[model samples]
Target: MNRKGYYSIQMQAVCDNTRKIRDLYVGYPGAVHDSRVFRNLPLCNSLEDKCGRYYLLGDSGYPLKTKLLTPFKDSRQLNYNIKLAKSRYVIEHYFGILKQKFRQLFHIKLRNITFIIHFIRAACVLHNAAIDDEFQLNENIDMVNEVLPPEQDLDFVDEEEDRDARRVRDDIVNDLRM
Candidate 1:
């Protein structure tokens, strides 16, 4: 249980530029830190092999790795941060779309954790299928007024930044400046 006195599950997902979920990891308790949950994900183990020349964008809660790029804490790289934020919007938008389609995700009432995990995975798969089929939602449905759950606490202990990842980030920032 989290400090908020509610049981929760932590879910992690990786989406492509098209807003389709490429990978997902869930079933972690809500009390677990974001970094810890990410590290335990199967995708984290094969990230290097899965993404050869590409890097995944992550928020500050995650450690900067060769395959995963987190924003620099320093404010000098404003342009780089801005560009990264724009690119990162795809994943955020995917979550919004997922919740909009599967309202059960907003407050899943299933008592079985395993079942909840399966249900979430099924929703993701169906979401991808819907995208492939070019399914459109009703225009009359109010998308702006949907109330979402409160954001989870994301503060985590800073992991040691990989020197190679730092160098890679620096190169990208320099390239952005040119």
Candidate 2:
């Protein structure tokens, strides 16, 4: 946490299967990237007692490991890499909500590294607490409950349209595979 002088530090958070953030890691200022920073999280003896053990999902900026998740490849893996890849975006969206709601963290007036990271962590804890405290449905904002419906269904479309859309997606996915 002593490292400082760069605004390019990576931030990390462990999310639940429901996509609610269970833990947060603001990270030390420097070259520590997602993969290493992610694995460095203090692990507990039992996953039941430890949060985020469902898995660590991160962006391509993060490294891939049995303990951490990233995009899938045809390359052999011990687990289902493809599924984790599809789900990692939730963490990115969580970050978006965080920055949007707590803008101060992004623009901490304090120059000290510990203060910057600590302030962010404090904000995240508050945010998580708010989420934990409030379970009411926000109908005015069209906000859904914490638990989401399984495998959201896309807009209703004809079979032909769906097939064509999927073809385009498959093409893009295939291109990325190359």
lDDT of each: 0.77, 0.53
Give the per-residue lDDT of model 1 (tens digit) for 98-135: 99889999888898889999999999999999878988
TM-score for each candidate, following the candidate numbering? 0.83, 0.56
How far in Å is the alpha carbon of 118 misplaced in model 1? 0.9
What residue runs in model 2 are displaced by over 4 Å at the alpha carbon? 1-6, 17-19, 44-53, 73-83, 135-178
lDDT of predicted model 2: 0.53
lDDT of 2 by residue, 1-178 (tens): 4456436556667766444677666755556544455446664222235533444554445433334434433444313345445565566556666776788756678877777778788877766776788744332222222222223223332476435534544444465566
lDDT of 2 at 151: 30
Model 2, residue 96: distance off in Å is 0.7
Write down the worst ten-residue block by lDDT for model 1: 141-150
Residue 14 displacement (Å), model 1: 0.5
Output the TM-score of candidate 1.
0.83
